[model samples]
Target: MLRLFAALPLPPEISRPLRKLQKDLVGARWRPEENFHVTLCFFGELRHTQARDLDELLGEIEAPAPTLSLEGAGWFGRREPTAVWARVRESDELRGLASACERAARRLSIPLERRPFTPHVTLAYCHATLLEDARAWTERHQAYSSEPWQAGAFHLYSSQKRDGGPSRYIAEADYPLSGFTAPEGMY
Candidate 1:
């Protein structure tokens, strides 16, 4: 079985700018630069057959390309935090895309995610003594905001636990948004 989910991969241009903001935050257990991605669905482990069926179901989705923006910083846990994340502004396209993925999951008989989707890229997770300092650091640099970003495609990712920190991810399949296609003769 392989763990999977659809997500928008951040382009280097966006990631680079985010990296700078990440540098300003001190005392938080930061996520590795490579793990920065916006998750669309988190379909836990599935049987091999289910995985193939999921791929087929995902391929049928057709929605307009979505534009997203990262505007602010937020944390998951209040006192002893479990995760830190960058927040995404709500947009119709994004909500529709998320809804579509949920429908697909239901169709495939995959367990539907009960948690409300609050779009954010996790920045860090763990018990750290610098929570207060991290919050202050985040506030000091909260003005950072990038231009609207177009999400042309989303991918099914396989996640695995890593020794040093958060789980690692690998792209298993990619699905393009409506009216967008990969450059001719390329994968």
Candidate 2:
């Protein structure tokens, strides 16, 4: 069995700017820059058969690709600071893609999330001490915005357990966004 999900990977051009923001928040227990991504759906601990069926189902999906922009910052777990993340200003494209992924998951007999979708790139987790600092940094740089980027494709990822740390992720499959094109096939 493997833990898996579909997600949008951050492009280097976008990530470079975010990394600069990372530098400004010194002393915070930030997520490693490479781990940054916007999750579409998380499928935890599925059998190999399920994973293959999921990939096949996803391949048949067709939806217009949407452009996404990271507008600001937000915190989850207000009390203990479970996470710090960048906010996705509401976009119909993003919501549509998320809904499509959910439908695909349901068709494969995977459990669907009951919670509403909130799109954000998680920046840090497990740091109770970083809450105040995170809030402060967010206030100072709340105006930060990235150039709109294409959501050309989303991937299915496998998460592997790790000792004393966050789980590691590996891309299992990538589904191209309909009506979207990638430059140089980079993704």
Candidate 3:
């Protein structure tokens, strides 16, 4: 079985700025630079053939590359914080890409958690008692903004846990946005 998800990888230009926001949060396990991405849809695990089929279907998507922007910061849990993330400015183009990915999951008969699509790049997972600290940190960095850039493509990634080491995420395939030049015809 293969564990996978679809995501938009952040360019170095954008990722550099985001790295600065990772500091000053106590009791938080910050994510690595290689793990930074805006997830479109998460498909936990699938059979080998199922993964191949999904990859084929995902490559057929043809949306224009959307210019993405970052704004503010927030935590996932309300009272007891569990995660800290940088918010993505919402756009119809972004939503369309996410919806298309969700549709692809459904077509593959993958059961997905039904919830409002909230797009954000998670920065860290925090201890539960740090709610106050998380909020204060959020407020301090509320005016944050990153230079907008075009999302040239989306990727399928596998999140693997290493023995006695941090979980590492690896990109398995890339599907370029319509109108973008696909390197070596990789779709």
lDDT of each: 0.79, 0.79, 0.88
Q: What's the lDDT for residue 149 in model 3?
A: 77
Task: Name the candidate, 2 or 3, with the larger TM-score value.
Answer: 3
Q: What does the lDDT read for residue 77 in candidate 3?
A: 84
Which window of 10 residues has the lowest lDDT sum in candidate 3?
A: 178-187
Which candidate achieves the best lDDT against the true structure? Answer: 3
Ranking by TM-score: 3, 2, 1
TM-score of 3: 0.92
Cα lDDT tens digits for candidate 2, 15-96: 7677666644544557766678888888778999999998998888787888888988876766665766788776888888
Ranking by lDDT: 3, 2, 1
**Per-residue lDDT of candidate 1, residues 1-187 (tens digit):** 8888888888766777776656544455777778899988888899889989999998898988888898887766567656667788778988898888888989987996688888888776646636676677558656767777788888888888889767888888899887654445547
User: TM-scores across all candidates?
Assistant: 0.85, 0.87, 0.92
- lDDT tens digits by residue: candidate 3, 39-147: 9998888888988989999998989898889999988887788889999998988999999998998998998877688889999988754778999989988999998
lDDT of 1 at 48: 87
lDDT of 1 at 70: 87
Q: Could you tell me the C-alpha RMSD of candidate 2 in Å?
A: 2.6
